[model samples]
Target: MNIQLNQKSDKPIYEQLKSEIIRLIMCKELREGESLLSMRALAKDLGISVITTKRAYKELEDLGYINSVPGKGTFVAKGNQTMIREQSLRRLELKIKESIELSRQLSIERSEYADIVEFLWEE
Candidate 1:
C-alpha cells in the first residue's frame, strides 16, 4: 500500500490515507480478500499515530470495504466490483460538488476552473 500525505493540504492526513486506500481497492490494486497491514504496522510505516490509522480503518469497515476479526487482521471485503465502482464514483461526485461550491465562492472563472479540472483528470 502506498500513501502520500501532503502536510500543507487542508485535508486531514488520515482522510488522505483513507481515500488512497479506497481508490486502490476500487482500481483492483488492492484486490478483494487481500489482507491489509495491521493498524500498528501502518502507523509505524506512515509515522502517524495508531489512533489515526484506526479511525481510517474503522471508516472503511463501516463502509463495507474491509472486515476485521478480533484475532485475525483486517482484510479487503469481497463483492461485486461494479457495485464498488458505483459507490466510489458516487463519493467522487459528492466531493466534486463540494469543490464546485468552493470555486463559486472564490469567483473562479469557468474556463479557469475547467483548465484545473482538466489537469487533474489528466493526472
Candidate 2:
C-alpha cells in the first residue's frame, strides 16, 4: 500500500509497481488475503493511468503474488513462503556474485574474503 513510483527510473512504471508489490508481499508487509486498492483507486492515488496499474496487477496475478475477485477486489495470495525464500535466495546469489567479482578485481584472497564475510556476519 506504500508504493513509490519513480518517473526518472529506467524501469517502466508498471514494472516498478509490480516489483514493489512483490517485495511487500514477500516481506509480509502485504499479508495473505489482504485487500488491495482497486486499479482506478490506486491509479488515482499514484497519479498514473489505470492501464498501468491494471498491467501491474495482471502481472502480479500471473506470477501468483495476488488474485482478483470480480466484485470483491484484489487480495494477496496465500502460501508464499516458498516463493519468498526463492526470491530472497536469488537476490543473495546476485549479491554474492557481485562480491566475488569485486574480490577478484581487488586480488583479495579467499581466506581474506571469508574473514570479511565472517566479520560482517557477526556484526
Scored by TM-score, the top model is 1
> In candidate 2, which residue ranges exceed 4 Å CA deviation?
87-123
For 1-123, candidate 1 gives per-residue lDDT tens digits of: 877778788999889889888988977899999999999999999999999999999999988899898898999998877887888789889999999999999999889999999999998
Off by over 4 Å in 1: 101-109, 120-123
RMSD of each: 2.1, 4.8
Query: Compared to the true structure, candidate 2 yields what TM-score?
Result: 0.70
Cα displacement (Å) at residue 75, model 2: 0.4
- Candidate 2 residue-wise lDDT, 52-83, digit = tens: 99999998898788899999999998775797
Q: List the candidates' TM-scores in order.
A: 0.83, 0.70
- Pick the lDDT winner: 2
